[model samples]
Target: MADLQDDPDTALIAVGGLDDPGPSPDKAPKTRPESGAQTLEQARELLAAHPIADGYSGVAQALRESVLYDLEAGEGLLETDIPRLRDGGVGAQFWSLHVPLELTGDRAVAASLEQLDLVRSLVESWPEGLRLALGADDLADARNCGRIACVLGPVAGPALGDSLGTLRAYYALGVRSVTIAGTRWTQRTGLTPFGHQVVREMNRLGMLVDLSGCTPETMRRTLVVTNAPAVISHHPTPVPDDVLRQLRANGGVCMVACTESSIREAADRLDHVRTTAGPQSTALTGAYDTGTPHAPGLGDVSCFPRLISELLTRGWSEPDIAALTWSNVARVLRDADFVARATKSRRPPSVARLLPPLDA
Candidate 1:
């Protein structure tokens, strides 16, 4: 296998959580705060109303809404729209299996699994044009065929049962990666007595140990102990100083979360790690609906392009962007033979570190 971290051309952008619908996925779609991304009407109105901001809220909101309305509407949220946007330039996404704690009786793992099953059914039932991809090849194939490739994973870790056996099952079912814990500790994996055990098991099973939702201690311990390259699926960059050090020491991967946090914030985090880990560091943009945040005056959808463009101006490059947006993530999933086989040969050709040119 090629040394992925050394690959110069391809990088992966791991988007967290495509599994559970929003807190109110079924709620009737609305204009403003009702939807994180904008509707066509909202986008048109926003452009007519004022100038787009240079931050995350405005542009992302507009772009997401534009993608959905322009490409996806009746096909449902997870159908054609997301891939279209990625093809349009959003990058690979992690189809999250998120279950609200309230609705799941705190059985997040089981709920997550059920949601995964739901995704499976949807993909299985996909019309002739759509399919669910589990590896780098699947994404490569999709990209080659002018289709969007997605990885089936989680936004939070609580969704996996407490036992290593359950984690193993997830891997067995083509779940190539996972975030360790989401928001809190759970009986099976994170922030508890067995946290170390879970990390060890994940390493043993070759599953990526995601520290996206873990506490500092949990993140610290996981980075220090794990043997393989673990991931922080959806987290702010520059990780806390200690975590960065731990990640460097452990030779793990740190995926940037592009959630509510700004690109500057994410960039700063990435820079911090790069200072220590060298230029090989990779990060992902948060895919959660940050287009329209809860904060007042920050929900506009006209700001994403400029915000992202400005990040490029500031020092981030296209390949860097590609790493965060596509290649880095592709590398991770491609590493998994199971996902590769499942997704067919769509995965990118092997390489070392993220670079700009590829035969694909």
Candidate 2:
């Protein structure tokens, strides 16, 4: 098995669930009486035009571990719920089909599949609030229907169990993005040949390549091998300036996490990224339930409007905020699909041989 070196601090964060089945995002406006209340209302209006498309989340793991949480009312201790996400103006979320590093082989595969099932079930249970986003176009449809589009991905590269077939199976099952989330890939340095094969296969399958928590070396290597846009699902921090330049060149967006800490703190991080790499290279990730150290103020999914309001107060224009919150992710997803269609016409599915698993 290959491990994906992680740099979560600079990784592009990606996704979770929304609904209305027998279990989803629309309602009247919120009238919070906090300070700077007027700017907050403006920010909410802007988000109404360009709602958020959060790139990553680990809430599925949290959800899996807990049995008492409710998705609609958010009655328990979960970081996200339908009202909060809608209040946050979230239009899409990428639920992570996470397979823990501690699990390997069939166990990892089972975990991945179970998480995938869990995400789908969440969407199915609340079709009015959450819709499974199978493609980039689905986001707009989800928004039109007043539902949060739920996308899927697995940061654990080993979740495929060293099998290209499993990758395809995941794609078929709504896993649209993949990251090298392991740490000891094949007991080798950087991505293995099979790993490169995995990247190409994902490209061929029209899936986005995630670089969340990947080291610069691994990130560079993956960048070289992948043609479709790759994202850095960062924990709301900027990467090295040079890597930022390379990522910009690749037309990839660095997903700045918003649900990590105080609105002012997250704003500072977003401001740094926007200044360092320009707004075109930025997107928002809720960073909910990612298990990173948490802080007070603006920490839940419902707080995105407040984050946007802070940016507005800082002289960040509405268009730039829209790009950060929505358009960048939409463009990345569209580009990946376009590249896959053209690439698939020229190449067949990968048939690479999986190497023997190495001891951890």
Candidate 3:
């Protein structure tokens, strides 16, 4: 990660949130990448008209660790804040409710609720900048009102504790996604029988099955059972090319993370997704506030246009870039909602549970 403190994008450009707002950086002189001045300008126009719908962020973890660092204050300690997200052209953002993998059973569930509450508080504190979105409709409503739509989710699947009732409780509480994981997560194994039931329940409830850290075989197996589309949320490692192809066939999006040390690597990673998975299957995420966002080009959330410019230089068409930034993710969410409505007629809430229970 390059030192972004010296970058014009962050240093010169003013970015802060309400109650401690900085001078607006909107009029600051822009940096022209090798992508050319014309392409960069075009990128700005594209994002302005249709902001990106990011798939993952870890701000909850940041809030959990800091009592002094405030998102509303837009402190220097964090990669994402309201003002930067405003400048970044993020219309909709999925905020990860982080429950550490080490925390399991009821403890994991409790931790998830605490993190979710933090995210809710963060959004509620900034009604002017953020909106809690329960579905695709809410995402659009937030955008129309000039709010960054906040989609909440738990990054650890253990939060459910293998209880279908608990899954329903999460859905009722506005958790639209959950990262699939377990002790066997690292193994090249498919989902077990209970896992299939969980997938079914998620489909019926319209919750997204996130396959961020899932093994290739597990992803494939989940795809086999999932009626609603899935997402490969931001993960440290690159997704396999084969998995991208499968996700495309499943009407899913693989959110390419921009958590790289440099903007060039992030752009290349996104481009790789385009090449391997086709354009419609590609989307963007910064994995911001996860301690990995370090590029000067993407020093913070406000630098989305920089990434868009680099993509243009790589020969991505304007429409394709627009879809990648907005339409594709929107379509996935809509499809999930539609499937959930349809699946409800065919299936009821599942009664499945981990037979012996993992905690015991």
lDDT by residue for model 3 (6-108), tens: 1111221111111111122122223334646777788888898879998888888888888677686687788888888877888988889876668877898
Total backbone collisions for each predicted model? 43, 35, 0
The estimated TM-scores of all candidates read: 0.60, 0.85, 0.86
Ranking by TM-score: 3, 2, 1
Candidate 3 residues lying further than 4 Å off, grouped into runs, are 1-35, 183-187, 357-359
For TM-score, the strongest prediction is: 3
lDDT tens per residue, model 1, 1-360: 222231112232122211211121122222223332323234333322221111111212233334434323334332235433432344345565555556432376666676667656555543343456765567767656644444566534555544556667787776756776643333323345355556545544546667765677667655555545566666543468766656644444566444444545545665555555433335444444432232222122223333334344444443344444455455554333432232233333222221222552
Candidate with more favorable, higher lDDT: 1 or 2 = 2
Which portions of model 2 miss their true places by more than 4 Å? 1-35, 183-189, 235-237, 259-261, 357-360
Worst 10 residues of 1 by lDDT: 50-59
The true-versus-predicted C-alpha distance at residue 267 of model 1, in Å, is 4.6
